[model samples]
Target chain A: MRYAFFPGCSLETTAWDFDRSVRAVCRTLGITLEDIPDWVCCGSTPAHTSNASLAVALPVMTLQKAKHMGCPVMTACASCYSRLRTANHKVCSDPDERQRAERVTGKPYDGSVEVRHVVDVLVNDFGLDNIRARVKRSLSGVRVASYYGCLLTRPPEIVAFDNPEHPSCMDDLFKAAGAEAVEWPYRTECCGAGLSMTEPDAVNRLGHKLVSMARQAGADCIAVACPLCQLNLDLRQADAAKAYGAVLPTPVLYVTQLLGLALGLSVGELGFNALTVSADSVLQRCEMVVSAGRGGRP
Target chain B: MENRLESTGTSFLDEVQRRSGTPISACFQCHKCSTGCPIGPEMDVLSSQIMRLIHLGEEKEVLESQGIWMCASCEACSTRCPMGIDIAGVMDTLRMMAVERKVAPPDARAKHFAHSFLQSVRHHGRVYEMGMLVAYKFRSRDFFTDMDKGPKMLMKKKLAFLPIRSGAASEVKEVFKRVEEEKEQ
Candidate 1:
């Protein structure tokens, strides 16, 4: 299967590991991703939080470029997916805005191009059953908390992908890879997304709550689909502990990283070491690594 | 932290409606938005109270309160609201209005960060994390805040030194120009 990929700005910088693991996992699954030519930033939280028109225009520009690829546009970052989808919705739903945006974008965006998250592509487009067929060394006995920290599913009408209240796509994805997804609340809670650095105190408090909830539920590692979520849970975990007074070595991992490991991809290939909390001890306990002579199935 | 509740010449509700396109009259004070909000406790005015303030045309109070900045825009309130009011979107509208009116200071660095981030994207087509954060420090005048995060993220190779500009610089510029024109209208 071939598709156009729009790795937003975060992927190139802070979430570089997410970008790497996404490519590595797709290579194993035989999914070819073509880079959208002249692709720009998705406008992120800055655009919407400041000006409405810029938010609509920035993503529309990229989505317009993705249309040339004539396939689904996949995004690794949840914030990018939300921005792109919001732009698509605005132009499709309003004729006046569409006419105005057409003048700016130089194309009619009837919202034809499908903007999707990578996890959605894996579970629905690629089929979880098909993905399960490729797992050679499964992550048996490893308990994972599927963390969906807003954007992939919110303001249901705009995103229209998963259940807003309680999402299960990530859970099914982890289970297919042979890891038991522990049921936990606060999966869709806010993680102080754009304020991680600016307002460190509030973010640390929020992160502390999320980590404490996950640890209380007995998750060995936290799996997320969004870059900001992974950063707050993994990188700022120490600050969260210091603020909220719970110290657990709960690792935060990207969903693809966990799935890639189960698919027999090496730790390095999946960017496992990028995580602040170490996954070595947990993976060792689960006996996930195959011998040096044997690799995952091709 | 009280703002002088003054009568405005322009309709405050109309101003919010013009910016966000969310109907303030639809909110029936269900308080569901407040109950579902994760950061409601941290907020000084809470979500439902902000909606009421908007209705009452307490423009200064609505903009000055930490509630709007505290909102993470998780859409939890937007999704759970019985009347289908986009409380989160309204929060965005309030934040932008606050910034436009130059009311945000000290408490809402998130607003300043967004402005700096937009400046970086307008220049480079994507975010240079180190560059954007540095510029935000200068703009917000909080240079020491979150400075410790630098060395660690740099060591992890999370902060790229240089930004890669693609072929869409002119197009992005045109888009920003149009947005500004739209705001004027």
Candidate 2:
């Protein structure tokens, strides 16, 4: 299967690992991700509060571009997926909004292209059996907390791909990849996005609580779909530890990265080195860490 | 009590409504938010009390309250509110207002961190951790708090001394510009 990929802005920088792993996983699954050229930022947090029109227009342009490319658009970032899907839903459901969006993009968007989160494509399109068949090494000993964050599930009508309250998409993806999915509260807690900068204490305290909850649930690592969440949970963890005088070294991984590893992709290909916490110890425990680093491009 | 009341011009209710957009008057004093708050035990005041202060137009008290700083913006109040008020948004608005007024909590470290985060985002169109940490340490003069932590982070290869700028950084700048204009208006 082939689809246009939207990596969004954060993936290119802080979450480069996600970008690399997603492409590697897609190649392993025989899927081609034709990146939409010159794709802009998805306007994740800022757009929602700044102006509704800008938010809709930003993603509408991408969708229009995907339609122009004649392929369905797939997004790995949950915030990007949510924003694009929200824009897509608004355009499809509201005619006046759609017309306004078309005017902004200078192209009539008939809502022809489908905006899909990577989890939806993996679970619904690729199917669990197919993913299971490709897993060379099972993550049997690895206990993971599948954190779905707010954007992927909330405002359900716009991104109605999974259960808003208790999403199973990540759980199912981890299971298919041969990892144990742990149950934890705060799976949907806010990682305090840009607010982390304006309010680090609050973000640190909250982040610490979320990480602690996941660890308390016996998770060796936390898997997420949003780059912001990964940054807060994994990168800011040391600061969080100091606030509470605790040590939390739990690694955070994008769902695709874990899937790529389970599919036997090399660590370098998945950009493991870019992660804030090294996955070698955890992956080694499961005997799934690849010895060689043959950088493969999708 | 009269002197205290006269000292603050606006009441908490009016200040809260003005800042939070949550109708303090709509609250029936139900403690659902307080009851459901995961961090309630850690807070100086219950969420319900904060809502009540807003309704009462006790603006000075609400704005100066430690509760504003303690709020995690977890949306637990919003989730549990039968009144459908966005308690978290109210907290966020109050926090923003606090920052604007320079009435942030007395923690210099926290204040420096907040400033560092905004500077990083404003400059790079995204958060740059290394840049933010360096800025925070330099600004706050708390150089050694995390001095030992950095080497450990580096050992784990988690510390990237460089900031990676986004490819579509200009677009991000435009978004920020638009947001600033809206805020000004």
Candidate 3:
């Protein structure tokens, strides 16, 4: 299957690995991801607070570009998916708003483009059975906490793919990738985004609680959808530890990275170097690689 | 604390009912939102206590509490709510209200940063990352903390030097003006 790919700004920088893994996995699955040209930021968190209309317009422009390509659009970032889906829903449901959106873009958006989250495309379009067939390495002892974060599921009507409260999209993906997905209470908690710089204490406090809870739930690593969540949980986790005077180490990974590993891609190919907390121990336990080898070998 | 009460006329109970849509009168002192709140453990005032304060018309306490600012806006309480109320929206409304009333949390950094972000967007028609960060530090008075990372970001070419202007900057301005006019009304 071929789809238009929108890798939002974060994926280009901090979550570069997510972009790499997404491309690698698409290749393995025989799917074509045509990059949307001249795409702007999806207006992640700022657009929603600053101007709701711009947030809607930003994604609509990308979707229109994708429609020109004549394919459904898929986003690697959860925030991108949420914003895109929100724009699509609003344009489809409200006629006046849709007209205004079209006037702004100089193009008609009749909700022709389908915006699917990476997890949704993998689980629903690719199917678990097909993904399982591609898994060369079985992640037997690796325990993962599938953290969905807020944007992917909240305001459920906009992102109608899963149940907002108890989402299992990541869990199903993890299992298909040969990893054990753990259940945790703070899976849907906010990572104190955008406020990480402004209100570091609040973010640290919140981040510590989430990491600690995931650890207490017996997770080896936390898997996430949003880049902001990954930043807070992995990057700021050290600062969060300083606040409580207790060092807690918990690595976070994108769901696509795990799938890439299962699909026989190497660590460098999956952007493992971008993560703050080292996943060496977790990877060691998975035994995809022998002590001497760099790449995963069956 | 008492002085904070004289500023806003909306009573806590009224605001809570308006924002949450749950009858604050029927709370029965239950702590469901608190218990189910994943971030409640880190909050200064538990979610249940915040709800109770709102029920009692303690607008000062409810609005001033760090609980409002600390909320992750995750909607856990709203989902687990026995009365099917939107507790997260209540917190968001309170936060927005607090900002409007200038009763902002002691840590005004987030508000200042948000304002800085908007200023850059309004002027350039898009967010100018370096300019926004510089404005944020100048406004918040914490310039040196991440000062080093700025150059690294620029060096890597990750930070956009030019603002990506929107097609409808003037229209967006009109929308903001309309909101301001509505506020005046």
Candidate 4:
């Protein structure tokens, strides 16, 4: 399968590892992902929160670029997927808003391009059976809490991807990769997002709740589908804990990284080293760790 | 807790409904949105209150409130609303109207950051985090907002020193100019 990739803004910097690992995993899975030339920002929370016209206009411009490629545009960032999908929904469904967006961007956007998240690409496109066939090492006995955060499934009419309240796409991927997916209540909860920067205290309180919940639920690690959730739960974990004298030691891994591990991709290839809380202990516990350059099956 | 009620005319509700494309008149103050809102405590005026205020035809106070600026837009309100109100979209429309009408915003830093973010996107066709930071710091005059965060991000290579342009930024700028000329209600 082939797709036009839209890496969005955060993937270029804060979430660079997500970008690399996504590319590496896609290549290994025989999925062709070509980049859209000169794609602009998806406007993220800033645009939609500021102005409706600008929000719709910004994403429509990029989707129009992908439309010419005649392929589905795969997005790794949850925020981008939400914004892009919302733009597509608005332009096609609301005639008057579509007219305003067309007038603003000075181009006709029929909102016909297909926008798919990489999580959807992996679960829906690749299928569990095909992915199970590629597992070189089993992630058995390792319990995982699949953190969907928001955007991946929210305002259901806009995302239309999975069960908004209880999504299982990431859980199914974890299971097929040989790990047990833990059932948790905060799977679809907000991770404080940009509020992490603007309102650190609120973010810490919320993040602490999520981290503490996952740990309490008996999961050794948390698997996230959004980069923001990964960063907040893993990177700024200290900030989350220092809030209420809590201990948050769970390792947060991208869903792709876990699958990449099962596929026997190297530690470096999966970018595990970049995560703040190292994934080494969990990998070792699950017996998925490989000695460098040995093509390990242990 | 009298609201100093204003006249219930003036097309404010219609304008908000038109801009957001949501059924503003359908909101009946179930307060389900307020209960589900995670940031409702942080907001001066809660999510349900904003809808209620608009319904009461109280535009001035609602537009000047900090609730719109503080909202995380997590969609808890939008998702749980009994009337299927796109409550978050109404927040966005209020923010836009607050800007275009030149009203004094309760949160100046957020407004400044929004402009800086758009400026960076307009120039580079993608976000240049460092450039956007500089633009924000210059405008807000608050260089120490995240005093050590920038350098730490730089050490981790999460913040670039130079711009990462798409080489076709002219196309993005064209879109920006056109959006500026948009005269839609």
Task: Name the candidate that leads on DockQ.
Answer: 1
DockQ order, best first, reads: 1, 4, 3, 2
Give the Cα error of residue B124 in candidate 2, in Å: 8.7
Candidate 3: tens digits of C-alpha lDDT, residues A1-298: 9989988766665566678889988998898999887565566555554344565676777777788898889998887887898789889988976986776666788986888888899999999999889888877788999998887887676787888878898899889877888889877777876666766677788788888888888898988888778877887777789886575588888888887878877887777766778788778878855343343211
**lDDT per model vs. reference:** 0.83, 0.72, 0.73, 0.82
| lDDT, candidate 3, B48-166, per-residue tens | 78777776677777777777766665656766677666676577566666776778776656566767876665564445676788888888888777554556545434466666555
lDDT of 2 at A197: 46
Q: Mind sharing the TM-score for model 1?
A: 0.94
For model 1, how does the per-residue alpha-carbon lDDT over A132-207 read when each residue is reduced to its tens digit? 9999878888899999998989979988778998899999988998889999998999998887767778888888
Query: lDDT tens string, model 4, B14-130?
Result: 778877879978888889988877777778899888988887778898889888877777887888888999998888788888887888474456677788888999989888988
Cα deviation in Å at residue A243, candidate 1?
1.5
Residue-by-residue lDDT tens digits, candidate 2, B1-185: 45433426375555656655566567888798888665566567677897777665565666666676655444547755778777766775666666666776655244456566545655665556678778987887767654655675555444567765555446546644654565466
Kindly indicate the candidate among 2 and 4 with the higher DockQ.
4
Q: Which pairs clash (backbone N, Cα, C closer than 3 Å) in model 2?
A: B11-B57, B11-B58, B11-B59, B12-B57, B12-B58, B12-B59, B13-B54, B13-B57, B13-B58
Task: List each model's interface RMSD.
Answer: 1.3, 5.5, 4.4, 1.5
TM-score of chain A of each: 0.95, 0.94, 0.94, 0.95
* Interface RMSD score of candidate 4: 1.5
- Candidate 3: list runs displaced more than 4 Å: A95-107, A245-248, A288-298, B1-71, B81-107, B118-131, B144-185
Q: For residues A30-122, what per-residue lDDT tens digits would candidate 2 score against the true structure? A: 989998875766655544433445667777766766787887899998778877887888788879778867765556887768888888899
Ranking by lDDT: 1, 4, 3, 2
Question: Which segments of candidate 4 are over 4 A away from where they belong?
Answer: A288-298, B1-9, B104-108, B183-185
Colliding pairs, model 3: none
lDDT of 1 by residue, B124-176 (tens): 77777778888888877898866677888887778878887757877887777
* Positional deviation of residue B169's Cα in model 1 after best superposition, in angstroms: 2.2
